[model samples]
Target chain A: MSEKAPWITYRPELKVLDCTIRDGGLINNHQFTDEVVRAVYDTCIQAGIDYMEIGYKNSPRLFPKSEFGAWRHCDEDDLNRVVGGHDAEKTGLKLAAMADAEKSDWKVQVVPRSESVLDLIRVAFYAHQVSEAVEMINHFHDLGYETMANLMAVSNITETEIDTVLESIAPTPAGTMVIVDSFGHLYREQIDRLYKKYAAAMEGTGKEIGIHAHNNMQLAFANTIEAIILGSNRVDATMLGLGRGAGNCPMEILLGFLRNPKFSLRPVIKLLQDHIIPLRDTVEWGPLIPFNITGQLNLHPQHAIKYRKSETKDDFVKFYDELKSEI
Target chain B: MSEKAPWITYRPELKVLDCTIRDGGLINNHQFTDEVVRAVYDTCIQAGIDYMEIGYKNSPRLFPKSEFGAWRHCDEDDLNRVVGGHDAEKTGLKLAAMADAEKSDWKVQVVPRSESVLDLIRVAFYAHQVSEAVEMINHFHDLGYETMANLMAVSNITETEIDTVLESIAPTPAGTMVIVDSFGHLYREQIDRLYKKYAAAMEGTGKEIGIHAHNNMQLAFANTIEAIILGSNRVDATMLGLGRGAGNCPMEILLGFLRNPKFSLRPVIKLLQDHIIPLRDTVEWGPLIPFNITGQLNLHPQHAIKYRKSETKDDFVKFYDELKSEI
Candidate 1:
């Protein structure tokens, strides 16, 4: 490594996306108060963050808007109420919403970029959903919106499955293809191999590789750093890692590591202190033992998430034995 | 990057050292109870850990007995009380204690191997104390104890200083030379460089390079894995990352990552559930905001440790400003 290695100074092309509301909604059914969402939006602008993923754009029919919060739909009125018609040109902070394959009714829910506040539509899917994800990305692109094909749960997929997904999405209009460590099971070595594969597949597509890591094994930030070192420019983080089970990479730590002069850490710190930490009373996230077990076993966090709500939440030995027996 | 990487298979030469009691003792002034120590001792044996550092061997003159605990001195009587004369032959687990440079009266404290339970004497010192550390290692080696030269706070030292210290310890009788990230400030890129540097310096000496990482950046386990990938066999971890500030690499996660089948995660999980989690009420550790800031700035965690006790502990913006002004 040279004295001027990218780790020392950062890549200028790097873009950090704050997914506090989008992923964090998984724990609380997208029920974050408008006050919390607005605080996150303001923090993203002040902190010079490149993008802020507000929430998911899943179908109201599938999620039932009566039960889920307004963010589950990310309606035009609900988004405007929180961000007041976010102007990406003025703030330099593009707004994004994750649209999961099969879960989202993109044909009707995803309006043209000119009509919505969202600048990007992140198409999340598993290996089997790659074909639909490609169509979603192209559709969103034709609607004049940026797009990313986030392949979720890549750790659980086979090498051939990953290759096929990459090949299918390689020719799409997605501006970025992300290596989503949905289970937080990947180590830096695996991140290195996956990054190389993604980079090779998107060699001439001009599409950047992104990283969206979970903190189940406490490697989210570390894995994100590893991805950045290997030239993954689009990265995802959340305030205080307030996402789903075991959260996402923390935005504060990620900003501290990135040497981009445009990024500021104070606003993020303030938001974490004032807004995110208070949510701990009703929301539980971080690399707890249950999540760590799931991450280590390369299993979905749903089991650990359910077990955390049980009376025997602290019975790690029982959890481990049960998880292992299932394998 | 190969299919059969070292990460996929076990390295028989690799040795894991559980520093739970020793490092975790810092938060409580080496005040762990007999039950806690005994539990950790038994866990190490059942988990098939190679070595367990019980505590520091500093002199009573430097640290008064009343102010500290028995682990600070690690007297034979206390060792016997907890472990019942830890027999390395029978348990396949070696007991060790850290003796800090200039603080330990090794001449009077470190008894001969035949007269005590300690199998290894870890000599921890700063760059300026390398000469003293070398002499201490030699003194302990003559007494028939295996030894390690733990260069503390390598992240704060200059390259030339590191080279000088490595040169001085190369000819010593120490069995391992540890890259101690005392401040928890190193990243994987830095770990790669430091590992290569230490490996080259220790070449042909038949000495192994070790890693003793702190988790201020939540990178302890990740960095430890990086070192292991680069052939650092002697690794240090504590249960639940229970150490001074942000703690050390977590033993449970480390055991989970290592491919060695001899190491059992069940013992570690049980220990965490039964012994470590209960201590959280009295002892606070982990990568909180204060510690994370200090780690990112490459500063000692003492300031963060002190700030964590203040009335405005959660006022991260104020803390960040004050810390930055000092820098």
Candidate 2:
């Protein structure tokens, strides 16, 4: 507190994105209705959020069924129908979509090959596929979409691989470089190390940093806090942590720490009441105690998410018996 | 990446206290059934949670609204019945209560106070009454309840004022210091500074740090993450994030991050599915975009919380027009 500025010395001032709908839609198989999507986009616009991701526009031909991919938004035309022609007053809100590296062939991912309904294109790359993602980001960059490379499973990557990838893209004109926690398993220390890595990689380049967090380990919000505090310009979140598996960092939680008041917590509450609440009746996405203990133990929580679903019957005793031998 | 030790590190090992029943009761007027309470207590026990706050134990005699304040197990006898004789094997949980420094008399706040039943007694203190809370913690300590001073609405206090009050609790006995975000408005930097204050004010002493967060502006979980990363021992959350106004941190998110396989995400999911989902059909919690904006603006969210509840057809619309100004 004495020498360095406070922990919040650096944060993004340009714009924010609430991914509750896009990321959260993963939990429900991307089945969110147009009405719900419309309301979400409307609120994002009214709240002055700079971008609202309607859904993934990448062609289904790109994804391999074995890879466990979910298209939070499946159709760009449908997305455009919902948020495309909002009154002129809602102008600055650009639509965005996400695509994985292993999935879509970049050439086929776009619907209108020459024209993009979306303003930005994000390439979410598995750690092993940074090169492919780089090529895609370059492709998007060439296509005039504000390109970004969202490196996934970052905690598992070595510095040498990270350096190779960064050195490749450091000179490219990608708008921003993002550190995406595909597994939502990072601590403040991990984020600090990662932040400095990404920051240093972009040292002389003209680009900003973006963070996408998963809450599988409950570090999503904390990790985001650390990233923004360390000078990252963009932070992403979903409503109610609605993404796949353990979900993404919650947008609502981020609202609490963002030093500004341009956003409203009311619409989020309303969406909870109107859409999110109803979804909870049918879908399940939240934390469990075994996962908490595992976090305490520095273990994986996916097994707990599985165990919870299996615990309702006399199965708990058997599951324990089986896992005991391996656990 | 070369940094050996990060100043702040989020250790997911902290214990989580889920008060969904008690806090959700705020929205539901304490309407939890015995089955629901029993199920939640039992699940948390199997999960190895440290604290299961049954409900408000403040004597109904302390308030004119006795019926309203008697929430869940307010009396020691009620506590015994709800948890079933405090066998460590069954619930394996210690009980806690929210004792108001101003509203609760010592006798009413702590009945049959002893380590045998309730293990922790947290004294909720308004910014103006830290001395009273200190006295209460001292008394509870003498009576055998592990006590803490939960400084509330801390966002309103000046550093100098907090320094004076914290100085009174200097030499804090084991487990007697806390920094509570009553308004849920404090951001990352505020928490960092405050935690530093708490650590400096109680260095070398046996006191442990506790964080009780509100979701007024949706920062509860985020701030709790900061607190944990900065080295606090306990973090407060509620089932489904149920509490006053917005609510507290969602225990599921905490547990999700904890990463223990024994602590199933299912029970928490089931709780949400069976308890919260239907309840949400009638009540709402979570960050609304409008409220997210207000929090972004660094303004109090209570105004938006109030405005959104208006029964008037166009109330929210009318309210939104004057929102950024009224607050």
Candidate 3:
């Protein structure tokens, strides 16, 4: 991707937020060295990225590495080092990290103490764990960190389930509630409807709206574009399409589409050629045979991911048939 | 891209066209093997692609192998051999190809000869040479092919220049005049202004609007999306972003964003992994160094393409500075 682009019209409504070093770390055992993290962080900043989600800032001592949702490399000192060197744009240069709902005392750990460390502390919740996530969101608001309650595994979730969660979050003070396309299976109209519904529910709630997407269906980039176009303020991406399975939305592509000169592509490309590509040689994130099969069958993606990694091609076909027949 | 996609609501007003194999061949010397062409054609059909552009149809004698924009290996037989095998959909599958304004003689060579061969015959013109191009459009229209006048190098053209050409095209039975961003330079706002103006102007004369975009600044995809969102119907793309520098708009990505199951990504990705990726490894068609510099500096892309093949990176930077300083 070029930076000194000619007269091509850049969409002003589009905004790019890079989570390459952060979200991409999931595939690499959450292992990004200091230099690699610094390079990715600094390059993303140079690439005119709107926000840089450094990593999840769960209290490692409380949640421990053994627990799920405690995203690695998210201690205060590690985050401080990432966000420190960028003497860059003041506002919208947000630092985000995620916390789990089932575990972790967000009121005690995330609110008061983590304020100096994070600008935004996102509370990720399973369908049934909205209460805990809401508690954390409120605590972050009281502590003054821009907070978002992300509804995770939305594919498996029901509308009533989400509405129940929204109803609980209706009176919160944080910025927004994000539609996390954890499965990355959504198309344009689905996102449009979701954005509209969420926007309508949060209209007078004082919370802003955001969307985080995965690229399972390759709709992540376009879906994010649509969300922003329809008024969702924040869009998330990882460098070099890095994340679990097919990876998250690409930050570089988003920046170019966003057309803000503030976002550059060189650093992102440099990161790709230097770090992401090399990682691909080892870590491997993108369309897999099983994932591809699920995509072909038009079935739920989790089943595809699970079957592909475990079952033979014939077995996967049988599984797809069985699921279809059952449906 | 997957086929077992979750249910999505698509904007009813939107329709997506995929031209990957056809336009992508510009860089492949247009000599793609029969298997490659067949698979691409089949994939487009499976993907439920609205329009599938096959290749150029012109007099083989005039467009000798030495000249550019010749039909390559693409002739009437080629279109039938590839597209003829598919289970043609009532969704309206149209085969399209390009013809040059100054070259390909439409009077005796292309018009009557190609009517039975292809569904649409598009007359492509440079910014300064649109008047001459419109003549070819009239001939193709007379021959019973859906005729389109693609005003090429349009980023360099002003509205008055377009108007001058439009005057002649208005009288013809030309079905459409495509806004060709041949230079890959126009921004979103510029595209919006251009599309609205052209669509409105053409409505009076009664012509559908079409668009062709290049991705020098990575804005091609977004620009097309924006144009479609705003109302333009006809869109173009190539498989694997294959074309001159930085390639054309990506077909798979566009289809993924489109609000239709017809554009299901399974077959598209399968062909990509099977055919397009191999081609890309053997051939390069993305951001070269010069396109990168121009994209960064927000300069014109056509200049960058010529510069990339001719000059060194250092020289390109010097050239970019010279161009920028002048601007």
Candidate 4:
């Protein structure tokens, strides 16, 4: 792809997906209050966000009804309460929900798009789970919902594995192939290489590339911007980066860089100041050193998250020692 | 220039400069305790940083002795107390200090290299002050100290003005021409353009391009990494990103990225935990909304700094309104 000077003009095809409630819920077991979810939904409308990912479509049996909140399943009533009955035709912004490959009971759980509030169903899966992801996407597509096949933990996957998965996903009904930096380990060069590879693999398939970066090494915004510059049309961000383990790219930062006239940063800033910043006391996320270590090592952030929650959060040296010993 | 994959191998020519005390001092008026300064010095040594900028050579007459601390002037005795003495040959790391174009009395205040502990003199100048900066670099070069001509507030300079200044700097003895993002307004694409511009301007001069970024928009580290990826060898960072309105890139983040076997991150982390984090209580800095606004508008962060100090620090909308009115 040619290096387009992004400042000269805006890319109308570029779509931003705010996954605050869905991703942020992972930090607090999907127990967001109606006020918080409503605030984010309103902010999305005012900020001109393309898609607001309300929550997941996972099985309540797996997550348990009492342990997780309504967002864990995104029951139509719960979503309707937030958006005041999601009228897809009237609402300026579209709604999306995540459905993991193995964890989600898509066959029984996901209803037709005409019957549901969600306009999109993003199917998240690992490299080995591409077949299941394809099935999930086909199912979602047959239901008339825009679908994305998000390959998770991509930094840990090998080149051969990634290529094989891309080939498998090429003919799937999924319209977008997401470059998920699950560990947040890859830097700009890696993002560049991956974007090129994904673009080349999806050539003539009418599929667009997407980016979902974690802020582990504090490069989520940078990585997202890199993918956008390299021609990724879909990007994922969370308000104030409130996802698990250092969070995803902050929506405010993404809006600030997009320079699109339609996107208003003021509402996003207001939401951050009024709603998201207050969550800092109860929720823990951001670029802590342990997270950075795990991100740099291309390891899962689970150990880092556990260490962060432990009483010895300040003892980075000991954590580093333990981490290296495991390696 | 063709894009080279940095992940294939580490850039051996890259040099990391830690300017924690000098930059962080802006937040606390250069009044860092001797203990803190010495701790940073020790950390820099242990962390295997190539250079440590202790402070500035600014004239006390301009800043006033009573108002600013010893670091504002960087008296030989004050520097000697930290380094013990200038023994660049014996010490693995070299000591450096900054000198603003008109703010510093470089001709008389800067002593001969043999009489000082400093191994380098970095002259910071605005676009209009390149002549004075050139003269300062010449004097320092003559005095047997390595020199760098840092063009401050590069995001605000016009393309024509930048060309004229770069042309003027080509003949100077300064071994490094720095792209200083004084306002921190730039994005990755801008950094790429600047790096390419600096590289083309300094072609065949045997001089290296350096990057000094502020964290106003939380892009300092990303911009620094972009510059490095595009072949800027000399990069500046501070511990915990402690500096003015926003701050600089965190040294720990930079060291973690370098991938050099000799660089140890533990020392930087320990210093942050022991020394820098405590300073946050008294000195406010980092990516606040007001600072980000100024950075985005390509304006000096003085007004944002003042707004942050006042009782209305929480009123982001008010600040935005006032900032836009002034703009």
lDDT scores in order: 0.93, 0.66, 0.65, 0.89
lDDT (tens digit, per residue) of candidate 3 on B111-205: 35333446677777776776777677767777778777887776666679877877767777777778877666666657778898787678777
Best by lDDT: 1
TM-score chain B for all models. Answer: 0.98, 0.85, 0.83, 0.97
Which is the winner by lDDT between candidate 1 and candidate 3?
1
- Name the docking class for model 4: medium
Q: Determine which window of 10 residues in candidate 4 chain B has minimal summed lDDT.
A: B1-10
Query: What TM-score does each of the candidates earn?
Result: 0.99, 0.74, 0.76, 0.97
lDDT of 3 by residue, A1-327 (tens): 224332344555455566776577666556666777777766765666666677665556654566433236366555665555444345445566777775555555554534454677778888788777777777777777777788876656777887887788778766778888777666565677789878988988766678888765455666776777677777788876788776776665665556556666556666666666677666766644344444434455657545545645334336545565776
TM-score leaderboard ranking: 1, 4, 3, 2
Best by TM-score: 1
What's every prediction's RMSD, in angstroms? Answer: 1.1, 6.1, 6.2, 1.7
Model 1 per-residue lDDT tens digits across residues B1-327: 346454677788999999988999999999998999999999999999999999999999988998999999998888888887678989999999999999999899878999988999999999999989989999999999999999999999899999999999999999999999999999988999999999999999999999999999899999999998898999999999999999999998898888888899999999999999999999999999999999999999999999989999879999999999999
lDDT of 1 by residue, A1-327 (tens): 346444678778899999999999999999989999999999999999999999999999999988999888899989888887679999999999999999999899988999999999999999999888988998999999999999999999899999999999999989999999999899888899999999999999999999999999899999999998888889999999998999999999999998889999999999999999999999899999999999999999999999989999879899999999989
Q: Taking the tens digit of each residue's C-alpha lDDT, what string does model 4 give over B1-327?
A: 234655646777889998988988887789989999999988888888899999999999998988898888999988877677656666578999999999999988899998988999999999999899889989999999999989999889788999999999999889999999999889888888989898999999999999999987778898998998888899999998888888999887788888778788888878887888888889888877788788878889998988987898888878887888888
Name every residue pair that clashes in candidate 1: none
How much DockQ does model 1 earn?
0.84
lDDT string, candidate 4, A86-164, tens digits? 6655657899999998899889998899888889999999999999999999999999999999999998978999999
Considering only chain B, what TM-score does candidate 1 achieve? 0.98
Q: Candidates ranked by lDDT, best first?
A: 1, 4, 2, 3
Better of 3 and 4 by DockQ: 4
The per-residue C-alpha lDDT of model 3 at residue A106 equals: 56
